[model samples]
Target: MSTQKRTVLITGCSDGGLGAALARAFKDAGFFVYATARNPAKMQSLAALDIETLQLDVQSQESVNSCAARIKQLDVLVNNAGGQFVMPLSDVDIEAAKKIYDLNVWSQIRVIQAFLPLLIASKGMIVNNTSIASVAAVPFQSIYNSSKAAIASVSETLRLEVEPFGVKVIDLRTGVVKSNLINNLKETQHPKLPDGSIYEFAKDTVEKALRQDGFEGQGLDQAVWAKAIVGDLMKKNPPALIWRGESAWLSRIASILPHGLLDGTLKKLVGLDIVEKAIKEGRH
Candidate 1:
């Protein structure tokens, strides 16, 4: 065992988020962790834990460049800075949806491009944080699902593109782990009022589906989830795809089901079956 530690740079590591959890887990595993956030102050506790912290807004090229410039030996790069868009596509504000893609999709490209030199030198790996939504688009979160689906595509193309350079890119299709995202997205502004759209009469049902993360015993702990991620990445022959989280198996099942069956199941689970019945009965 060498005392010299491999360095890892992770974005969106604000406290209480999975990024911060990864920072701590990697730090505990003897990796030098660079925990970054759009606002460094949000990661003050990470600094207190002796992990290096950087201020990085992945949406801004300058910010990405500055952060990349400061890293001299990045052995692993994690793209985790992203937001959620929870609404029907018809009512999804195009501008806001673009912002979601900017953060969720393009930010990964920006950071990867900026740090490619370091990764190439280290023969390192890129871990992209995508969601199971990529496999099966959720009912109202179409924008979010599509954005992750884009990353899913990018991950495959990138893995092939970077393999000859001795760099590996892994798409981590994470299932819901407990995080502040649910709380944060509650504040997300959408153009459609819940009470005045296709879901107007099914507002409660729709909202419940949005909030119900398929977790076991409360939900997966962010720390445990992060540990699993870092653990898998550290494997000698890490796969191109690493999938795990609460009810993650369910997502895998959902992904392979027949299209009609999957669609019908999702609609019924979200109370759409009831909504459809109500609509037919003059309820809406």
Candidate 2:
């Protein structure tokens, strides 16, 4: 009987985020957990729990290669390190948008490519932490939403490509879970509609909408969400797509419904209707 413990490596395990919570849950589930963040110091909580924490800047090829080289064995790889950008497409900083894409979309591919050898050897699973926003578009988040959508698409294609190696690919279409993603965005980016921009007339409304995306106090607890996610991932034949979090079901529903039907509701939810009215009235 093989008594080897299953090993899992998860990225973006900074404190107070989904990655960290997942590390704890995976540990409790009896798997050897490797929790990582761009800055190891941010993983103090996980380190105190005795989980092996590493520094992994997903956007850096050298960092990803170094992190992969350290792990002798891996049964699962959870790509969870990502960033958010909130601004109208017209006024968004191109470089900032590219940075988000690098972190959210390209970085996942980078890590997967770097670690594919280990995954192929174990015939393990790859879980890409995409979001409900991939399907359900929200106002002022064009770049972030599209990046997630691109990853979801990539995960689908990757599933087919990796099947021959006995590796499983899972697209985790996450809904809103309580995390510091938005708070970090607010502190670091403070995205705003530029002066003289088309959406400037709705600056307050846009900014408020950005801040109140149902993630602050309304989303599922990170630990709770992580538990459910890990439970699903640990199944004998884990599902290809798992949607678990607040409003996840709603996003699923929206994905199936006609976009025309959802357009008005989405616009109203984010106060885009008022912005449209103001634009039509030449309020800009």
Candidate 3:
């Protein structure tokens, strides 16, 4: 218990992503950071800095328990390691959907459940990296959107429940962060795509959506978000939800929009109408 240094653990940190940036930010702020990923070797960059990298896969109970057992003290817990896959509901594969949920939703739950005791002991803060898609259902990404939505719900409840213990739970609504998630999309055949079906037109559109992350030129700066996150965590009592990036406001607006209007808008924005047109043209 060094009074001068804080300890923070973050999940899903590899290289060139929000997690990595957060790791650097915490280290710069004079905190001991545990940068955890499924493959500890992926976080080699942290070696040059004053950060410890650990192996943690949220989906595996053993991995979560092992990591939790090793953590004796922690000031902050950042659940930043989750990913998304975009596929039409009609074309969504059950196994792929399960895997995505395993990573995005269940993993967070496992981590929080496992590490909650330590958080309570330190009276620390929990930052759950939710997304703009949590509230707004984007075309071709129903599952990812749902998972984040679930996180937002859990964060809200956890914040209240842990308040009595002096622990803060923050729901971070992030928009368009530069990350390697695009490069790691699972490449498998869609179960809903038969020899000829409506989903055939969606293959290209879905690919683009799955690979597309962050704004083209004005995405959220990972360093900026990281610094802000650490600063907020240092506050005596930080806000419950922190919206990061330019599109954060847009997501708020979308969340309040009428269902019909929102669906129409998303369909146009994500090119679902184009896919429908292609299907009509017998492109499958």
Give me the candidate number with maximum TM-score. Answer: 2
Residues 1-284, model 3: lDDT tens digits:
34446889999888877899999999998888889999988888886784789999888999999998887888899999987677668667789888888888888989999988888988888999998889777877889899999889989998899999988899999876655555565334322243454565566665555445343445767788788878877777678878776578788777777666666667777677777677789876
Better of 1 and 2 by lDDT: 2
lDDT at residue 187 of model 1 (Cα atoms): 57
Alpha-carbon lDDT, every model: 0.84, 0.90, 0.80
Worst 10 residues of 3 by lDDT: 186-195
Candidates 1 and 2 compared: the better one by TM-score is: 2
Clashes of each: 0, 0, 0
Candidate 2: worst-modelled 10 consecutive residues by lDDT: 209-218
TM-score attained by model 3? 0.88
Which scores higher on lDDT, 1 or 3? 1
* lDDT digits (tens) for residues 138-196 of candidate 1: 67778998999999999999999999999999999888788877666655652344445
Give per-residue CA lDDT, model 2, range 1-284, as digits (tens). Answer: 12289999999999989999999999999999999999999999999999999999998999999988888888999999998888878888898889999999999999999989999999999999999989988878899999999999999999999999999999999998888887898888876677788766778888788775555766899989999999999999998999999989999988888767888888998899998999889887
Which stretches of candidate 1 lie above 4 Å from their native place? 1-3, 190-196, 207-218
Residue 113, model 2: lDDT of: 97
Return the TM-score for each candidate structure: 0.92, 0.95, 0.88
RMSD per candidate (Å) reads 2.8, 2.0, 2.9
TM-score computed on alpha carbons, candidate 2: 0.95
